[model samples]
Structures are given as C-alpha cells and as structure tokens.
Target chain A: MPATLAEKILQQHCDEQITGPGQIVRCRLSLVLANDITAPLAIKSFKKMGAAGVFDKDKVTIVADHFTPNKDIESAEQVKVCREFAKEMGITHYFEGGNVGVEHALLPELGLVGPGDVVIGADSHTCTYGGLGAFATGMGSTDVAAGMALGETWFKVPPTIQVILTGELRQWVGAKDLMLALIGTIGVSGALYKALEFVGPLASTLSVEGRMTMSNMAIEAGGKVGLFAADDKTLAYAAAHGRKGDKAIAADAGAAYERVVTIDATGMEPQIACPHLPDNVKPVSAVAGLKVDQAVIGSCTNGRIEDLREAAAILKGRKVSKDVRTIILPATPNIWRQALAEGLIETFMDAGCIVGPATCGPCLGGHMGILAGGERAIATTNRNFKGRMGSLESEVYLSGPAAAAAAAIAGEIIDPAKV
Target chain B: MYHGTAHTVGAHIDTDAIIPARFLVTTDPAELGANCMEGLEAGWIKKVKNGDIMVAGENFGCGSSREHAPVALLGAGIPVVIAHSFARIFYRNGFNMGLVLLEIGDDVSKIHDGDELKVDADTGVINNVTTGQTIQCKPVPPFMKGILDKGGLIPYVQDRLAERA
Candidate 1:
C-alpha cells in the first residue's frame, strides 16, 4: 500500500501494524526538546514520574532562548531550574547563554533534526522541521518528559491534506505570502489535526529557508504539521547543516490524501495578517499607510539568513522612519555571525535599526522592545494575536521580511513592490 | 450537585489570550491563573468562582502549544470546559492534566454566561441547572478515560513504567 510523507516517516519510526490516520501507535523519537519556559515543568514532571534519568542525554535538549538574559526574577528562576536539571542530569544538548537561539531554528542549524526522523518539542513550531521532511509535532512538557524517560511516545496518525501549488511566484512575493494566503483562504481550523503536504510545481521552487518559514506557521492554521517532500533542496540543507542521517523521504505516487486544495501564486503581492489573528490576511497594498510605531524582522518564523538578506536588500542605505523603532536579530548565534559576515547587520545598523543578541524576546512579549497601549507594529513574526507583543490594546501586523523592513523605513505598512 | 457556573467566551480564544507570555515567566498554576484571560478579558478572574466551567465557541485554545493555557484555566477553578471544538494541542494538554473537556458542538449555544451547570464525565452529559436543558457531549475515548481515572497522564505513565519494570 502507498503512504503519504507523514505516514511513511511515522511508520519508519514505529511498528508496521500502524496502518493509517486516526490509529494510535507507539513510535520511537529521534529528538526531544524543551525551552527554558517549558523545561522547568518537564523536569518537575520527570521527577514526579520517578524517572531517575533521561533515556538518552544526547537526544534530550533544552534551550534558553525564551526569556533569556532573564526578563525578571521569575524568568531567571525558570532558567535556573533548567540549568540545575541539566547539570544534575548531565544532558549533552543543554544550550544556554550565547549558544542559544530560537529552539526550532537552532535545532535545525545544529543538525540535530533532519529528514525521516520522528521528533517532538515542547514548542508548537516543532512542526517547522517538516520542511526538511522530518515528522515532527509539538507536545506538552509532560509528553516531553515521558518521551525523555521512555525514548518513545504515542501519536494519533493524522490524515493528509495535500496542498497543490502551481503558477510562478511574482517578484517580492515569497513563501510567507503563499502561506498567509493559504491560511486566509482556508479558515484557521481548516486543517485541524491534519498533515499539510505541500506538493506540485510551485512547491518545488521554494528554498529550504522559505519552506521552513512556511512550515513554521502550520500551527497557525491548526495543522498537526506542514510537510515538504525531501527533494534536492531538502537534501542539500541536511548536508549543509552537517546531518548525515537517512536522506530523502517522499510520499508514494499513489499516496492517500484526505482532501486536496490548490494554490496559485502568480501575480501575488506580499500578504499581511492583520491584528488579532493570523488568518485575517490582507494585501500589503490594502493596509498601506497604516502607521506603525515599530517594526521587527526576525523570529523563528523569518529569522534565517535568507530572511535577513531579504530585509537587508530592502533596507540597504535606507533609514528607519525616526518615529518607528526597528529591531533585528537573527535566529541563532551562527546565523547572527553569518548576517554579520555578510554585512547585513551593518546595513540594518546604518538603517537605524536596533541590533540585539539572538533571543526570542520581543516576539512573544518577553521583551527588548514592547509596544504600549494603542500602538501598532509590523513584524515578520508569527501570530498577531492580541497582546502577543505587548499591551492588550496594542496591535501587530504580520508580514514578510521584505515588507516588515520596508515598513520600518516607511514608518507604516506599505507595498514593498511599489516602494 | 453543581459542577460550576459557566464563564463564556467567543470563538477562537487563543492560548495567548488565555495566558499571555508576559505571565509565562512562571509555570506556577496560581501565578498563571491570576492572569488568565487578562488579555482577552481583564475582568475574567473576577467572574470565575471555584469549580466553575468554561464555555466557548469553536477553536477554543488555538495558537501556541503552551500547556499553561489549560493550567491557567485549571488554576482558576475551571475543572471542566465545554466548547464547540478545541484546537488539538489544548485538547491533549487538557487530558494530560486531568482537566475535563466536553465537545458540545452546536449544543454549546445552550450555555450562557453565568449559567449553572452540572457535568457527568462518564455519560458525557452536561446539565444546565438554570435553564433545565440537557446537552450530551461526545464521549471521551476509553483510553483517555483510563488516563483520567488515574488522575492524569503522570500516574498513567507511572503505571506503564511499573508494568515495564
């Protein structure tokens, strides 16, 4: 019988008896991850379960990217718990301080996650790895604790939603727009509990970085995961990241899909998710001239080097509108260094943007630059939900890196292609 | 017996609205609960009483995999929730912590803010004591029932570990 990329990757890690969607099965994990905010709770549950130690220290990783530099006493205490637990358990993959990055981006850059692997993280964006053809999903910290102790966890197989992509993307329009348009077209719960497999001619054109950005928003559409086939781009990314694991996994030609949806990207413009919901997408042109108090161009969603390069190309020799605050940080320390080497940092700095250390702060309101009541920001981050980046009355507009950077220069949401 | 009063919210009540990341600095239930729905409704905590039930429309608990969402509700004395549907992660997280969730589909409209409700987990029935209306929910799966019977996933995991030992 033929199987989908999700099915095939899952079966590779579990028993053969697990046939299809909705059937629960036990599967071994290649990696288990938690962040500073989550690791403390997982450690509490691990001790509560009376698990003496982790099943494999190398397979278990904890990152301090969230609220790092210690936002407050409570935040510091949370990381302190993780640090003490890491010391006590002697975990091989405990990353803190300067080594840290956003968990999803940092893991892929370090080659700890790759194609055909079964992975879980305490963060929702864990599904971001599916861009590399890995079968990954987010779990609660208790589930992470269980996977740490048992080296395996249970999954209720999800049916596949095959998204057929066609037509060529226009200039200044990229994967972020394609994904936002899909979410806007399909309601937030359109893919609930389903694996979104991006297939067809247009999908073949997206870069590995673009694909990761697309997959990172799968959760925004309520998808269990968003997946891409392990094509050449996927293999090249795996190799570049130093991963030597099993290479190339794809769906069978006759693979089963629950439903099919088609997206054509021709003549598209940059898309922006309006305040309060990611699915509330509108064209940048529609929202142009909407004043913003700030602009942020990085997160796990769009914090890669390519994303930075896109922003830099737009901001080179330009200045952020003096009224708007622009903050740019790469996803990982390595990515940060790469951006520095490429002078993207200098371009941003020259553009009057605030360059910060690699941290997930400000993206989720942990801090660095938070919005005040009634203010607005155009960001390249995911989720524009209320209070996501600051005060309850503050608003966030989500856009592609190019548009976000352009908005910083314009001091308002603008059509980048036009400007 | 009274299960709790209903604290109703509209559709697509996301995790961030439940417990914002600003309060995620601590995983302590009380700390999280104190700020529960602070973003969505600043006065939400003042409305909830012990053992209250949360009622919402479709896609409640969408966005983010933070289990803190359910923990905050649980800490606010919301031992049960009734919704048209739930985002998948919050559903799993709720069960993992022994917080009962009932899917009433269209029947969720039968519940109004401040309604008195009594819930029966075994039969998946929700009784609106105020309006005298009864709502039958989709039964929680047997395996999940097994987990809830043991108080939560931790104890269930403990049982499995014992069996392996």
Candidate 2:
C-alpha cells in the first residue's frame, strides 16, 4: 500500500483505494483559485455551464495580481469581471486593489494552503504551495470553472522523481540557484508529466520561504508539482500564518519514483538562466560582465520578504549603478509591511532602487519596468523566456536575489561575493 | 479523418512564445488568434490557413497555464497540432478546449512544413501525403477520448453532473 506523496495526497482527495499513474480519478479539492487574467474566463465558463453559484464559496479564491492596478482599459475590464463575479458569489477570499498581491505568495502567506491539501490554481505557479506539503498544480481557467462548480475534477496521478539534495549551499547561493541548477540539469521538459519529490539532508535545512521559491518554479521544469516533507519548518510556517496541521506528511518509505536525480549543493555558487529558457543555466562565473540595463528583484518566484532582505543586505551601504534602473517588489502586503518595518525599504531607497507595490507587474512585462529593444535585465523572477519582460530583442538573465542585487550595483552580471 | 496542411516549429515552444502576456487581456478567441505565435516568430498567424495542422519538436506549449495558448491556435485556424511531445498544462488545455493534439514522438520530424496530413483522432493514425508515410500517434486514453467526444471538459462535466442528478 506504499505510495508517493502525490499519490497519497491524491488518493485522500478521492478516497480511491487502488490506482497508478496515467489513470484518472475524480478528486475533491481543498482550494480552487483564479486571478484577474484567468478568473474572468473561468467566470464566463462557469456561466456558460449554467452554474448559478459555486460549490463552496469559501473554497474559491480570486486574486487580482496579474496585470492589475489596472494596467489598461482591457485589463481593467478583466478585473472588473472578476470583482463582480466574486461579489455576486459572495466569495470569502476575493483580493483586489490594495489587498491584492501575487497569488502564490499571498495564498501561502494567508495560510490558506497547508499539508495534504489538493490545490489547483489558474496560474502555473500555484504549485508553490507544495512547499507546505500540499499537492497543488496549475490548471487552465476552463478547468478551474469545472472545479469551482463541481468541487472536484479528474486527476492523473503523476509518477514521482526523487530529487536528492546533499551538502550545504555556499554563501550567496540559495534556493533559486539550486532550482536553476536542477532545471539546467533537467532541461525545460526534463520532468514533464511527473511530480518532483525533494528529499535528503539539504531539504530539511531550506527555509519554508526558500522551499516555496524552489516549488514555485516546478512548472519551469514542466513538473506537475514539487514537494518537500511537511517537517518542523513547514509546521512552524503554517502556525505563524494561523494554519494548523495535525501531523507531518511525507512519501511512504517504499514509494515508487520513476527516476532519481542527485544535486550536490556543496561549493555550488549562484546560478543564472540566460536568455530564452530556464534550463539554459550557467554558474554566475560563466556569464559575468554581461551588461544589465535593468535589475528586477521580485516576482512570485523570488519576491518574498527573505528575498528582499537578501537584496537589502547587499545594497545597505551601496548605491545601484547609475546606468541600471533597479526595481524591487515585495510579494505580499504583509511582506511589504514587514520590509518597511525592518527598514529594508529605507536601505533600498538609499541604494536608488524603485520599490513598487506587490503586483506581478514587470515580471510578466505587464507594466512597471519594461525593456526596450536590445536591452537586457538581470532579474530574481522566474523564467527568462524570450521577450518575457518586454521587447523581443530584450534579454533576461535569471538569478538569485543576491546576484540580482549585486548586478544592480555593478550594472552588469557579476559574482555577488566580488561585490 | 482530420485533414490539414502542416506547419512545423522547433522544440520547447513555450506559452509565452505562443501568446505573449501583453495580448492576454481578452478571452475573445479572434483577439488571441491574431497574436498567436507572434511571440516566437512574427507573421506566424498570417501563415495559417483554415484547418492547418501545426507540427513541432519536443515540449510544445511548455510554459504557463494559459488556456489562451491553445485557444489562440484554434482561433488561428490550426485545429490540429502534432508534436513530438507536450508540456503537461498545454496537453490538458488543448484537450479541455476540444483541440486535437497528437503526440507522434520523433516521427513528427517526418512531417515537413506544408506537408498534407490526414490524422485520425480515434485511431492515432497519421497519413503524410508529402512523405508517403503512415505514422502512429500516442493513443488517447478512453477517458480522455470521452472528453474530446463531448467537445472538452465543460460539456463533459455537464453530462456527468446531469447523470448524478
């Protein structure tokens, strides 16, 4: 009766006794999520399907993060649609305007997701909740609609890949580098149609926020979800945010994994994913001195308070290069408030960085900071796919917050330690 | 048989490349269609004729959970897509939208741009008139077959809920 963590969590949802990968079963969901860009479409579908109301208003969540603060008339209309729908449905977890933050970060910050929960969001980064030992994955808006009305949907249990991490990461190297290293090792399609299970000594040591960063980019590897054991750190994070879980969750000892990949974290330096692909990774040393016109230090992937603190620590007494326009976005309002409380905001302001509100802006090239033709940016956000942050000719270099902060100071990509 | 002319692209054509974030403002299919693949290559939509089959190397539709990616393709007159593989989200999105996606593994390379292809959705059989080859696609499971028959997930869910009622 042994099963992978994903299999166990999925089974718990449907109470299906026997199943394997590739077999579909209908499972209940702990949370059904959508956002400004996606919720409008889902609402349309929910109406098209003739559903008068949601299965459970409390379980449904809508966050206006993407293209929000009303980027344009069109995006404004999209948010309005979501707003009206949430109002009409009397949805408990609707977030917009001042309350809005990046969905993945805000959801975990609110403790809306915890161990053993099955979550599906219209945004791909929904899998970020896997940091709390939840089985979360992204679905299309249409899928979210069906899930909202029915409170359940079909799931194909994915095979698991055991990612064994050993040794400790060197200073200035952290979760983003580890994940970028893994994605580089696996290519973009390396973990397609599979769940990634993180284990080994290093897994227990990574902070919950760092683990969230690790799980946030699971989609970058084409993974169904990325999971860690619900150990003490996870419980503590949950409790701090007002969630309670009775027990820890982990894969059964004899659970099956389709593949085993080991990543040696010792002596590893900061990693960067170059232009066009996340799997197109290189050690920071490999691509030093690449000029950066913009340095963005936020997104759902690397926009937590911890990430900002790392950037602040580097920028404390230093100023960003006059040639570089550095932008920092704290992921949630609480994180933003915390950063303000800790005076990280003052450090960033003194260092010449533009502090923006908690929106997924600039990360998706929606607004805030856009790249011109032939311009390049060094960012702590996930994904460097071609033209992701602006002009098709504009290049994006993905890095950890330290490298991003250092790049802001140097006006080019460089080793953080050297700065 | 679903028939179309082929248009082949290389590997890892991400969702951002399929439809950029800037064009995601509307759920209108035509709006999404006009900007389809504009992120990867300009003038991509102009290349499509009605009922054209888009072919690609591995991991087509590899980023984001935007159903808009597949919706854009369908809106752009690409009713069928044959690729060596697909990322998890796009595969599900395509099926959920009732778009035909056939996984032909490496045999997808046998199809050249502008090749005439007739694909059988039920049998996973592909006939390439340009190469004179018969290729087998990765078969759809019976459960997913039912969803496709129902014209995607919404209609399928409606029927299932009706049965329960």
DockQ of each: 0.79, 0.82
Model 2: per-residue lDDT, tens digit, A197-314? Answer: 9999998989999999999999999999999888888888889988875358898898888999999998898999998999999999999999999999989999999999999989
Looking only at chain B, model 1 earns a TM-score of 0.94
Model 2 stretches with alpha carbons more than 4 Å out: none
| True-structure lDDT of candidate 2 | 0.91
Top candidate, metric lDDT: 2
Give the interface-residue alpha carbon RMSD of model 2: 0.9
Misplaced by over 4 Å in model 1 are none
Native contacts kept (model 1): 0.71
CAPRI tier for the interface of model 2 = high
